[model samples]
Target: MTRMLERAPNLAILYPRALVKRGGGHELPDTRLGLRDVAVERERLTEYHRVCGFGPSDTLPGTYPQVLAFPLAIALMSERAFPFPLPGIVHIGNTITQRRPIAATERLTFEVRTGNLRPHRRGRQFDVVTEARVGDEPVWDSTATYLRRGAGTGAAAPEPGEVLPTTAVWRVPGNVGRRYARASGDRNPIHLHPLTAKLFGFPRAIAHGMWMKARCLAAIEGRLPEAWTAEVRFAKPLLLPSTVDFGVRGRDFSVASGGRPHLTGRAVPAPGNATPHPG
Candidate 1:
């Protein structure tokens, strides 16, 4: 069942709620959290565009709705019923499908839920799915796979063998996390500062996985079809203050630094017959 919110939940409050629920249950929640008729926050969107290297456009970035729906996603995961703690949950993969280009002015309804609990070589994994609708027509949706490290299962996750050929390079600054957090409202400490990150086992602060995805889409923005799906696997954490190479072959892409792959993904446009109406 869906529970509608009067407004976006304050992340300031939700983060603490998640921390407090650290030792919660092992079952995923069935409740779907939602919000209706929410307009795009133009200022935040602009800041996001700046940080992610996206060009200005009348339409929303394919990943924008994910950030907009993120608070709801957290609300679902922070509940006492959620299995794992939010602090160390690593985002392992993400997939975003846009039925069509959504205009910036469009008001959207969003719903978020969690499920797909499963085992991994290093831990347990689950999905947080978010869907957005313009009126009653579904415009966009995304699934973010997160993992909580603990035990072993089948084989270890596959690794990207050799680095893809480079097409461009990016110099990611240390403060990108703070900039993105301000714009996207995902202030996970691991992405915030080296001190905070060390508390999570990282030598230095890392970049947001979604930020990497957005930057790649921005690099190839003109080539993306109006209706397409983008999927990516986060191979390794992108340490901040790094220089990374981006490679693309056909629809496939990867981001790497010093031949170590950080992310790999593909973008595939929907077939003409499968494209949805923009309105």
Candidate 2:
């Protein structure tokens, strides 16, 4: 674990250059990267919310803090202790939770760590955890799970959630993926142009799963609490510039297209001040 390092949110995209991979032993140990004092940037937050379709509110969007802290997370992943390459890892799922609605003006301290490598039917999997707090009081956290495809451990993947009957359809533009790429700074060639997508085995550009999660949250924002946990399992890759159906029943929700599910998720209440918030 490294000592706390402070930085501005805008530089998060390139902070990893300072870290060189020092591959770790088998455990994939838990190392505290550093502490970051995040001063919420309202302008960027509003832009992010706009791109993801969240209606503007004085309170920060539940997922915005995670984005602000991502640079630090990237720096942590760049450490010599990390085992995988920065590219090519597949994000299989994610979980985000918070004690209450975080105001735009609230101060935050971000703590990041990674661990829990395990076997999966497709390959190996691990988690990246990010936590934010006000002084000593915790407010929000996220766990982003990634899968490295290779040598299967024979551990079966988790069962998929039952698909919910859809209530609405969204006609996504062909350029939606590129548009999101600009806003999210995830310019993965696979999510931008068609030619680049085909290089990665995708027939066309695919929408970002995080974008899908944010869009889903925007649709059901009223029902989500400042104190809520959202767990999302990524399914079929969403073909860009296509229409997708959405359905929400209770804590269960899903996004699908061509009668196939793209993602299935559950949103539930979370207690305030919990530590090591699971993703």
User: How far in Å is the alpha carbon of 123 misplaced in model 2?
Assistant: 0.8
Tell me model 1's lDDT, rounded to 2 decimals. 0.87
Candidates' TM-scores? 0.94, 0.87
lDDT of each: 0.87, 0.77
Clashing pairs in 1: none
Clashes of 2: 2
Best by lDDT: 1
| Candidate 1 lDDT by residue in tens digits, 84-135 | 8787788989999998888888889999998888888888888999999988
Q: For residues 139-253, could you state the per-residue lDDT of candidate 2 as single tens digits?
A: 8899999887878888988755767898888887888777776666566677788998897789999988888888888888989755899999998888878888999998788
Best by TM-score: 1
Residue 177 alpha-carbon offset, candidate 1, angstroms: 0.7
